[model samples]
Target: MIRRLFSHIDLMVRLLVLAIVLASVLPATGRGYVIAQGVSNAAIFLLFLLNGLRLPRTEVLRGISHWQFLLPLTLWCFGAMAVAGKGFASLADSTLPSTVALGLLYLGALPSTVQSATAYSSLAGGNVANSVIAAALLNILGVFVTVPIISLLGGGEGISLGADGLLKVMLILVLPFIIGQLFQARAKGWIVEHREIVTWMDRLSIAVAVYVAFSGAVSQGLWGKVSVGDWAVLLALVTGFLLFGFGGSWLCGRMLGLSRPDRIAFLFAGAHKSVAMGAPLAAVLFPPAIAGMVLLPLLAYHLLQLVVSAPLANLLSHDPNVG
Candidate 1:
């Protein structure tokens, strides 16, 4: 059981470590940086295009009717989590770099993950269909909503998104997704047929984005700026945010009188932040150096969520009330 749980995490860690080390050693500079940035942007565009192809409109429509489940879930994810992120960022501002501190708020503004949330919900005997719809809706909304939230909360913290940044987001993320939806009938089938390839493409795009971003940061002295004590503080704060995400989401479910399965769906949907959205959005919203710094806390949170969620899902699967 333990082996099964750690196997996936082990592979994820290895890949991420490789990306980080590669970025550090051969950090992109000069004309190479420009090329890397272009590649990252193109990969992100394709990644969203594939995302749009995969998510069915029917699922989104069906899920919208369940306001009882969806409303609180949305509020918790965007409202409560955003507020918590602000509070944590305030706490970390004095201890960490300003950009990294602002990342806490950015993390809160992001949406729930689609793939992992639905997978864990199914594993925990939750409403997989609801999980799918909830995650999809949030991601769609996030495309429009996340930047506004950041601009609103992060204006004073040197994180404002000007017109150019907004346009970049539309071009890189939103435009490709709209195109994918338009061609979904034709391309979705091919995407499904080549699911393995599509999945790898998703991972590769994210890795490339991270690599470009981190490379910029490394070249700008990222390692020298962030010390051992700063790492400890970052980890501690991220763990606290994780706890609040899971615990507060569960309590919200209970308070709302959700059935066990629906609650399970809500729990995962509301708690998990999407790095799928984070990495690309950061690339679009900030320069490579700042984007890399902003991503530090999120990357840590993403890995820890995976580690914590596997065990939590296993435990939830054993709950007698989960039916």
Candidate 2:
């Protein structure tokens, strides 16, 4: 059981940690930084392009009909979580660096993860169809919705997305996704056939983004600004945020009277945040230094979710109520 649980700390997590460590020890600078950023941007573009190619339009269409489940899930992820993040940010403002505190809010406004959410939902005997659809729809909407929510909630904190930022998002994230979708008919099968390579591409792109972002933060004294006490506080706050996400999502499902399988889907779907989206979007929306700091809470939460989900999925799989 312990070995199985630890397996959740998979290769991707290790890569992420390695990226951070590399950034801490040997951060890119000057010409190297510029080159790294360009590479990171290109990687992000390819990542979204692949995302577009892989997700089936038919699944999205079918899932739209499950509005009974998706609607509440969407509202919870965007609305309730955004509010909770704002509250958490406010609480952390006095204790942590401003950018780090604001990270909690950014984390809240982001959408659910596609891969892990679906994988865990399946493991827990949830409605896999709904989980897939929910993940795709939320990520699609997140490209548009997350920034606006951050702008709305954190605008006073200098987090607004101006015209340039919007255009960058369109080019880097949305445009490639649209392109991939357009080519899906011709390319998706090939992508699926080469899924192993594509998955590694996804991981590599994310790792580059994280490495570039954290490099900037490290250059700007990221470690020095965040003391040990701040680390404890950050951990505590992240834990609270995780509990609220899973607990609130489950309660919302129960209150809406969803079936047990659906509740499991809701639990994972509503709770998990996407580092895939968050990292790339941050690269587009903020400078490397600010993006790195802004990603702190998200990075922590993403890792913890992986650790927690395996055991939780096992428990849910055995639950008599999960029919």
Candidate 3:
């Protein structure tokens, strides 16, 4: 029983949860906040560097060739999810807070997560290569697509499309990836040999990001701003959003005549949102006052997805029929 329980929970989840607890307790104002922010930024940059180095070029090429599979996945990530976000907000009427609702809509518009999606897809016997390429493209396009969608939804109030933000995305996320890909041939053997090191780095970076983001929120009296009832409603909406993504992706992939591996890729790539990018993007997009509120839903959704997906990935790994 102990082994079974331990097997189900991922270390990354545990670290992130711990980080949140610590963030809540720790002092985030004055010099501490500045220090936390700097650490978070550095960790994030390194995380992307490892991500670029680890991507398998062969799978990326294969994934790109299947444009038929890619098209719907893209549409679902950007279009269907965005529509569902607004629809859920409307359904909430006056129950949901405006800031949280706007956050959900923005979350929907954000891109798929590269690291977790690729990792989960690989664990589930999915097409890792295709996932890698698809996830990368989504983030790249996300820099452009997310801002526009947020603007359309009135979530872009006080947000400016700064060249610095776009450049930051490229510098932190894309540039490292390109460099890694460039030297991939030379590093492939070493990277594969030390894959576990890369995984830990990814987890640590995310944990730091969570800590910094929540530290700011905690400092701002996040719990005071949001009532228990509001929290419940937001949780419910986030749960519904995830369920829709998971179920719809599986159903739609089948309907589109995808192979089992392709379906698995679709399932993960369409369902997972980029926690790696969410906080930084929010910082760039929203005002400091509302940014914490806007960030809460994204953080909640990020943690929840990892919890839900871990077991699903385990099941898929064991199921002989899935691969």
Candidate 4:
């Protein structure tokens, strides 16, 4: 059944339509809003756990040693975006607020994605295990690193991570994967076999989140504060960043003279970032109003990447040059 489903592109099309509809109503309905937030957190946890399960023991450990390109690139790309995005505020006419700083810091702070990056890597004919290791490692490191950097960049309005909060992040984000890893052989196979279920749940979760987040913005009068022009500017920035990360990683991997599989792995795995990962973490780290703003550019980035990256993935997949 799952194999038949995978053969049909229409399933994705249909699910996407459903996601669009659900995203429309998530904000106004209070129950749905809370459920969306819960699902967002739960889905991220599931994604991390599934990622850990796929990672071979060796690659998981080697993620530390294999800091070759990914580590520097992650920092560099994030730094570049922060510097570039913050300055973007001056070009716009919106009332200057802490969001300018927060947006820039968020550029530097959010983790690389786990499931989507790995899936993109796999779809692009990359080494799935290596991608999993890289993605998962990025996620773990994010808890320790994001807050301090945000604090530095944010100044008076910055964020911080207490020891207890860090512990809780580890518990919520790390411990689930640790447990999943113990039973991975059983779970991963089932998930892979039921790819439709996994895809549906993942997309449903994200759609609900976008709905709630965007809805919350409406309720908070973001439209009055953030104009159509601001949205356009934000959209442009996100598109550019996604292009840079994906293309830059590919070029970097090629320059490293990696094998085809490894280069492909690095390209896709190193490129993608997560907006979903930021929502809960932002709630934990920042004031509520500010947290929502922090989420905005990320949401833009996430959606832009999906639309832009799909064709890029297909192009890479069939590229005679890659092999």
Best by lDDT: 2
Error of 2 at 107 (Å): 0.4
Q: How close is candidate 2 to the true structure, as a TM-score?
A: 0.96
Models sorted by TM-score, best on top: 2, 1, 3, 4
TM-score for each prediction? 0.95, 0.96, 0.83, 0.71
Regions of candidate 4 where Cα sits further than 4 Å from its true position: 1-58, 73-101, 123-125, 156-171, 174-216, 321-323
The alpha-carbon lDDT assigned to residue 262 of candidate 4 equals 77
Identify the candidate with maximal TM-score.
2
On a 0 to 100 scale, what is the lDDT of residue 121 in model 2?
A: 95
Candidate 4's clash total is 0
Find the number of clashing residue pairs for candidate 2. Answer: 0
Q: How close is candidate 3 to the true structure, as a TM-score?
A: 0.83
* Candidate 3 residue-wise lDDT, 1-323, digit = tens: 99889766667667867887897788466787888677767787777677667766776677678789888999999999888877776655478667777778878888999878989999999988788899987876776688888788665554665687667766766677788888888988988898888778888887787777677767877778789999898899899988998888888888998888888999999999997677666754664456667776787788788888888999988985753
The 10 consecutive residues of candidate 1 with the worst lDDT sum are: 6-15
Compare candidates 2 and 3 on lDDT and give the better one: 2
> Each prediction's Cα lDDT score?
0.88, 0.92, 0.78, 0.62
Q: lDDT value for candidate 3?
A: 0.78
| Clashing residue pairs for model 3 | none
Q: Answer with 2 or 4, whichever has the higher lDDT.
A: 2
Off by over 4 Å in 2: 1-8
lDDT of 4 by residue, 206-308 (tens): 4444445555555565556666766766667666667767777777777778777778777766666665456556645653344556666676666566666
